[model samples]
Target chain A: MKIIAVCGMGIGTSVLLKMNAEKVLRQLGIDATVDATSVAIARESRDAQIILTTPDLVDQLQGLPSEIVPIEHFFDLEEITAKLSASLL
Target chain B: MASPKQLSNYPALAKAFADNSIRVGAIALDREHAIEMAGELLVASGRSTPEYTQSMLDAVAENGPYIVIAPGIALAHGRPSEAVLEIGLSLVTLAEPVVFGSEANDPVRLVLGLCATDHNSHIDIMAELATVLGDAESVNTVLNAVDSDQIRLLF
Candidate 1:
């Protein structure tokens, strides 16, 4: 499976989200490809199974082939862990 | 092999804060002032040009406050542009939290200004900060820190 962590510019915030998401996938003993992309790119593409982003940005991705998983708290690892388990496991 | 904690790049982000660029006080006004202060912290430390703050402000006006990365914490940054001078970090805790009008996260108190020379250069430090601030308990600890030393020692 593949995941994309997205934010406004795919510069700072999205990169952080991508790293944490990779760590979560590793901790769960799951193998998946995760990429950090900008909101614009994520909106135009559907190259990943799930697009992880903050709740607010989800609206901007109105019609997309990929499922948008809006994370409530970006810093919390436990939240990421639980979200991944529920969706992928 | 070292544990996951050891592998984290908290040290990289820690150095910027170690340069004594943090300001903890009751800085009032609006979100722009808070962001400007955070940017000033980076500029005064020689990490960025004056254009860095303007770039940050422009990004907000164009994209909204997507910088509010977490509850009570705002990670302010702009793209790798001419405004960027160097890689830097600035942590400012306000006495009164300022609202950035983010739909999800608002009333941010921790303004972490990220000045990256390029888009990819600051990824390591940004990831490190995210890891270090991953837990509510840790976030609370940093929020309650009495001095810059206390917060700097966190990373």
Candidate 2:
């Protein structure tokens, strides 16, 4: 599966999430490609299956094909995993 | 690196400084600009000056990801000596995202502006804010909030 982690700058926290998600995916034995980008760039890149970001920016996505997983806390691994698992299916 | 325990001190910090504070309008344009704007509020509320604001940015820039703690939130702060008259904190949310550096996962939407009189005090508040922000649900509540009053309710 392909996943895109998005924020305002396409750096910083989104990259951190990508790193954490990579570790989590590895532990779960899930083979998924994760990329990070800004919301603007994410809008342009349509190859991902899921988009992860804060709930505030989730509403900004007016029309998009990817399913958005609004992440409130970037440090909550369990919550992030739970949300990811639910969305991936 | 302070543990989550160290981060739980944000509430007292908030309570201590919330009085006599003014809430500003939300910036819908650039997220990075929100950080600066929030910092300005923090400085103004604390009766600080421009030097303090520059110092805050410098501290964050040197320290790396001080503000971009979580996903969408960025807590911009600096050493208290830079321009702190008193301890202060402020919250700013962007209607849109703004880029910071070149991290594959940045463009922060929420900025929690902070200013402390010293490093010790700053660490305490940082710890608390970190803990509070670690919760997905709580972070969502803050992010989805419409006004400063609503944002204050979360703290």
Candidate 3:
């Protein structure tokens, strides 16, 4: 699976979200490659299967090509897992 | 992102916080004050310029498209611009939590400001910061830290 973790400027929170997404995907026995990028860049990304991001960016992702998963807390592993469990399959 | 294959740099981040990046036990009248103080720390360290600080405030006013990442924690930053002098991080632990107007998370206690020469440079820092912030115990330790020096030790 191709996943992209996105945020405003592509640096801080998105990196964290990407790390957690990859970790959760691995722990759930899923195989996926995740990319971290800015929301502007993420909008143009066509190949990603899932776009894991914060709630603030969910609206910006409207009409986009991927599944937009809005995470409430990027620091919570369990929350990321719970939100991603169904999507990975 | 910095490098997908690289491990998170907790130690280096710890050292960086110790040497050049922290302000703890601060009091802010509101979220903007908290953000400004956090941004100023980076500016004083030469990591960011005054315009970057103002931009941060503007971003928050624009409704924090990315600042509030978790409950009680907000990370403030802007696009890589001339406002940034170099890549740096600054942390502020507010004595009084202030609301940033998030439904799930509000009354933030920690405000982290990041400035990068480019977007990619701070991705590694974020990875490390996430490691520390991800753990509830560490976040608690950070909140309880007496000063900037102690917070660096916790990192």
Query: How well does each candidate superpose onto the true structure, as a TM-score?
Result: 0.88, 0.54, 0.90
Query: Residue A15 of model 1: what lDDT?
Result: 83
Clashing pairs in 3: none
Poorly placed runs, candidate 2 (over 4 Å): A1-74, A77-89, B1-11, B16-25, B28-32, B60-66, B102-104
Fnat per model, in the order given? 0.52, 0.15, 0.67
Superior candidate under TM-score, 1 versus 2: 1
Q: Taking the candidates one at a time, how many backbone clashes does each contain?
A: 0, 22, 0
User: Candidate 3, A55: how far from true, in Å?
Assistant: 1.2
Pairs that collide, model 1: none
* Stretches > 4 Å off in candidate 1: B1-9, B135-137
Model 2 chain B weakest lDDT span, ten residues long: B16-25
Candidate numbers sorted by DockQ from highest down: 3, 1, 2
Candidate 3 lDDT score at position B92: 91
Q: Per-residue lDDT for B69 in model 2?
A: 54
| DockQ scores of all models, one per candidate | 0.51, 0.09, 0.55
Q: Write the per-residue lDDT of candidate 1 for residues A1-89, one digit (tens) a residue.
A: 88998888788778888888889999999999788888888888877889998776788876888888877678778888998889998
Task: For residues A32-55, write the lDDT of model 3, one tens digit per residue.
Answer: 888888878988888888999888
List, residue by residue over B83-132, the lDDT tens digit for candidate 2: 67777777776766777542534777777666666534444454455456
